[model samples]
Target: MDGDIYKIVEQPLSPDAVAASVGDPAAGGVVIFSGIVRNEKDGRPVKYLEYEAHAAMAEAKMREIGAAVRQRWPSVKAVTMLHRIGRLEIGESSVLIAVSAAHRREAFEACQYAIDTLKQRVPVWKKEHFEDGEVWVGLQGG
Candidate 1:
């Protein structure tokens, strides 16, 4: 794709769907990683999470990551990234990254890099709701 294939949705995401979307026979290796909302954060209970995003800017940024992966690893066949918005309960996946490549190494690296960079640079915001209170998390990697 020439433009952003990355999607940030407000509804629940399906990992199998995302994985199937990027599956290619030419690619011998496929790697998928999910960033889940755990029941606890730093030993504290977490009720739910709400994600917000600057749709246009966030998507543009994700496309940049995918393009960069393609450029860095020519063996990579495809890349797909999905992040969830709105209220999410604990144990739900908030983000998913899938990559296919000729070898396992490239797929793993590209997938990891995509998620890491997306968290640092993307215009998405997350609010954590706890029993006591709620707080927005950014650039913290928590």
Candidate 2:
């Protein structure tokens, strides 16, 4: 995880750039996970979202996730993770993760684990904006 990418940005996220960051010559499979701001949540119509994070702590947690992924999947070659802070419109990507591995299975599994763990542990919060109101939510699994 020392060389892995872990970032919290206030700008838009690029899936292609994230994927390229984790590209490895020896990797046979690369998986990218893009978490977007959907138009609705729990049946409520959402107009937008705002993400905030403890920048240093969030990046540290992401690094921990990357290290854990590599430890669990020995074939994982490279990893990249990014979270976007500030306002985001519907359909905008809020998070991007990329994992490169020797096999497709490993890449897919590791990528899944990374995102799940990130949601559970990262120091980030999201506020969903609706026509009626807005609510702040922690980055935790439901």
Candidate 3:
């Protein structure tokens, strides 16, 4: 509740901005994770990607993740999670997560938890577009 940032937006997410949002004076370390769109998947050339989600519910789920992080790692000072929706080209970030804590280990672990939980629990859908065809996949994989 103190320092948690969660959002779902159509615009591109900036790693610097997400990290800045989680910056804290008491925090000794901050870890950021960016999930970007790659050029290929399963040996198939990917043209682009499109993401969609129930924005409000997605943000609420992110807040829940932050709460879980704080509960699991009390040292965590701040958390920020942003997921970008809509058409994204190769190399564009689809998700960004940042965590700040009293130590590097907690920050790293908390960031990992936030991302993994997000993929598993958040109701976001992903569409992979290829030159040949397109496929819809759940956020848990593909």
Candidate 4:
């Protein structure tokens, strides 16, 4: 809602799409953050990652984050938060956040805040699949 794109999808994520969603002719700068699945974690080799979420809740939280960004930085032109669920291979993007604003500083700050707050507040869980085993990652686990 609110004209901002906040979604959880099973399909692969596209950074370009996320960026495009926030494109604004009046905005001077655009900031994007692509959270890619890494090959290694804590010195262990990671084969892939599995992401699961209470989709409705996740999207709601994401929207809240976007709203917060807009509130904190009134100059923000547009904001988007897109996350991909299901299995993701190393080097693939799992999450993408884009922010467009009248200035670079506002775009950068809002984009950073969107992602950091999303990680801490969203109801999404990431499971790391290692060579030896798999583990759920979150505050109670990981």
Per-residue lDDT tens digits for candidate 1, residues 1-142, read 4422598888788888877878778889889999999898899899999999998888889999999999999898888888888899988999988998999999999999999999899998989899999888854577
Reference-based TM-score, model 1 = 0.93
Give the per-residue lDDT digits (tens) of candidate 3, residues 1-142. 5668899999989999988998889999999999999999989999999999999999999999999999999999999999999999999999999999999999999999999999999889999999989999754373
Error of 2 at 61 (Å): 0.5
- lDDT per residue for candidate 4 within 1-142, as digits (tens), equals 2569999999988878888888888899999999999999878999999999999999999999988888999999999899999999999999999999999999999999999899899999999998788889865453
Better of 1 and 3 by TM-score: 3
Per-residue lDDT, model 2, residue 120, is 94
- Give candidate 4's error at residue 32 in angstroms: 0.4
Q: Which candidate ranks first by lDDT, i.e. highest?
A: 2
Residue 137 alpha-carbon offset, candidate 4, angstroms:
1.0
lDDT of each: 0.87, 0.94, 0.93, 0.91
TM-score of every candidate relative to the true structure: 0.93, 0.94, 0.95, 0.95
lDDT of 1: 0.87
